[model samples]
Target: MLESYSRCWTEIDYAAIAHNVEEIQKLVGDTKIMGIVKANAYGHGDVECAKALQKVGVDFFGVSSVDEALHLRQNGIHDSILILGYTPPEHFHYLIEENIIQSLVSYDYAQKLDAYAKEAGTKIRCHCKVDTGMCRTGVIYQVQEKNMDQILAEYRMEHLIVEGIFSHFPVSDDLGQESAAFTKKQIELFEEVCDNLRKEGINPGIRHIQNSYGILNYGDLKMDYCRPGLLYMGVTSDDAIPIASKPDFIPILSWYANVSLVKWIQKGQSVSYGRHFIATKPTKVATVSVGYADGLHRLVSNCGLEVLIHGQKCPIIGNVCMDQCMVDVTQVDDVKEGDVVVLVGRQGDHRVTIDEISRKSHSINNETLSDIAGRVPRLRRREK
Candidate 1:
């Protein structure tokens, strides 16, 4: 069994991913699922999370960078890795040789990849990123209108394969008419682009657009394949996006830290950097070995952040330092040193969710989890 000495570690439940994938499979009946393991599986451990999802029969893994894909390859993961983010021109050759699928949004970028692939006697399978409404890293609809044929004529080479067509929804979670209408427009545009390509004798292999929110709220968007990242860990920003098919999904990560030091302070005593938190009473404070440096958002300061100690809820006190935080365990009876503090998961009936923390910290759920940096160890949970 793997454990941590710092008392602070991320416990990843592989079974939860399996459970979530099963739910998604039932929802998207007949459609393939391209598991989005980008950003180290949204800080849920990429290699392990991808493997766990693979055990549940996921088709491919999606990442955001070449370095992330390379990490998986080095770890002996042979499953296909799709680089969803923009690949730099300098690394196009490396991307081709490594058998990693990349997204192409510019004609000039495609030409370089084509030249490299042809010289290496290999063909790179890439997806066309349509900037339907996201306005991010995709070919604009306006640009395509002016030079679709010209662009096609430039890179109509045998070494380049357009394997998939995808677009991103701007706001799939907001329950506003404009948000829904805009998302609908993006879906319509994605289809139009692919339809135009097919008419021009171009066959885009996989057609995907539904992200985590899209897969849940807009099932129609889950056409050829669905890419869901945050949902795999059992949370979604969009309440409309159903994940588990059950009442609710179980979060896959639990963050815990051991009580490093238990101390007492008189009333009016201040704690931590900038002396932000003061003792309201003769209080007991326990230092936890976790901070923003370990991916805990600094904005959580003065927020009603709670952690589980001695099976009881304790409020986090003071400004969170780079490597430590203080939690008030004064109300809890028999609380002593070395008791485990639940930072981001359940313990008994009390729990602290990543969504709750993210809201308090003024960030998104994905950023809250994926920001969990290194140094803090991760403990992998397996079923018997």
Candidate 2:
């Protein structure tokens, strides 16, 4: 039985990951894909997913920090990795040692990193981020000469190799007129920055502005690379707005647990903490070996969340505990301990998705998937 081996586990379909990459390749054509594998590949297992992605011809990877980049490197991932977030100055040497690219967030940050690289007698590869509208990081985008001057300074730094320039979209996923206009302006401003740099005789290395949403909506834009984080994982938020053209991306991960115990309760008996559920008549309750500690949100308790047992949807009863939750499995035929329980995946003709769990938990798909704890093992599988 599944319970005999593991209380809970995540099954990753490598074939599905490959399929999603192939679908994305078809959409973007020759534009290289920087497979975003940060946050443990959105909790899908970074090493495993990176290996799978590398096998499928993805030549670049994007991570959040130097540590994540090193994690990939230590795990034998030799692809070019770009850190899309901040890295402390003290760790600048690790970036050079590991041959990882850093995102130059601002002119001041660039100065500091360059100074450090100069002191170490080495040049660090970087991608300059232009704050085209998100207003989070990078040199603020302006068509004026001052904006160009700051960007140009990074390219001229002797210790820094400014190989690429990129920006992010705050609302490229939204097709609404207001949002579309904002997205369009962001693209235009980013392009203007790159064009201005080129006119100044700066190669600007590689220019990428599309994220997962950007690839779906504005893929026609010419860019050197496209960074697909969630799209590459084959799932989007449940509340995600409609896009121009939705690709047929296959989901790559499924969650499962095991039935730990089953019992019959008499009328008026309460189950779990807070006595939230009272049996009107005789009811059969099954304890599942997974809970909030396993990344199942506590807010989902008694919130109409269902699990699958013997291919039947069973309502989760009472409050979810740290390591276990109760399910009303009376309708399931011959429910027994050690039976497989599908938490976020298919069971017979029924399926529960990450978006479903996100909706019920009042969270987004990324948070829902990335919240899955590391304690639960991620086992790789290949479809026939």
Candidate 3:
């Protein structure tokens, strides 16, 4: 019997991740795959996923913040980890000390980091972000070209190493008119900058731009490296960008819990708080040890949500409480306590995908995964 320390736990499949990487490798061919382990590997568990990715020969690991990079480094992850977002000026010291690379988005940021590195008597590595179309970060490609050139030259003098130059696409996952047109323009602007720099003998170490969606859609326009975040975590983009051709992804996350209580309810009786679900007839209700506190969305409570219990699809009854939720298991014969109930992923012939839950909750799978509380331990499993 499968058991867990807590009734609610998130199971991660390292073997499935490896398989996903292998499948992506077949499609991308030589284009490098930068493992996107940001947001705790998109809530699948960061350090664990990083180690698994390392074993499979991933090119690089990209994180959202400096703290995330530090966690990986502290856990003996010596591979190159790029902080995709901003790092505070006060903590720039760790960047040099830990050999972590940062994305230099603005001239002021670059200047501050250069001075910080010099004061520490160490060189800092950074990638200049080109704001081709995405206005979120980086220098605007058109108006800031001259400014970028001067900054690059000044960086060399200040002993700041420009390890790479990259940009982000706003709508690389969408095939819609505006998204495609804008993405194409962004790609053009990004490439032109690289080409212009090289023409003037300015060689930015490594070039990369494509994200998970880009890898799926515009893969043929491969650059020096690509970032695979959601794909590596075993789910597609929320945008539902149609794929041209690629390997099928294996879902790497499975949320499970044990049945804590089971009892028969008489007709006209209600289950859980607020009397949300009233039984019209005799019903067997199995209470699961998972609730909103355990990353189960509150919206799912009192909603028509089903979980796999004893290889049977059981509908959730009443409102989901802080510690548990009740499910109708009357149809599931011989139902008892301690049965494994799957909230996400498959069990027997019945399956409840995270995508399904996301749709039901009117949210994305990534956001729902993030809601999974820290109390829910993520157990890594590799099926032999």
| Local distance difference test scores for all models | 0.78, 0.88, 0.83
Which 10 residues in a row give candidate 1 its minimum summed lDDT?
238-247
| Candidate 2: C-alpha lDDT | 0.88
TM-score of each: 0.92, 0.96, 0.93
> Tens digits of per-residue lDDT for model 1 on 1-384?
235556578878888887787777666777788988887888888888878887888868899999999998888788778898877777887676678988776666777778888888888988777777777776776433534553354336678887777778778765478988888777777777777777888776788888877777776544888888887788876333434234246678888777889888999999998898888889998988888998888899888888888778888889988888998888888766777778877778777788777877887888888899877788876566
Candidate 1 residue pairs that clash: 7-257
lDDT of 3 by residue, 76-138 (tens): 899998999999998988898899999886877888888887888888888888788778878
Q: Could you tell me the lDDT of residue 225 within candidate 1?
A: 87
Q: Which ten residues in a row have the lowest lDDT in candidate 2?
A: 1-10
Regions more than 4 Å wrong, model 2: 1-4, 142-146
Summarize candidate 2's per-residue lDDT along 188-212 as a digit string, tens digits: 8988887888898889888898998
RMSD of each: 2.6, 1.8, 2.2
Give the Cα error of residue 154 in candidate 3, in Å: 6.7
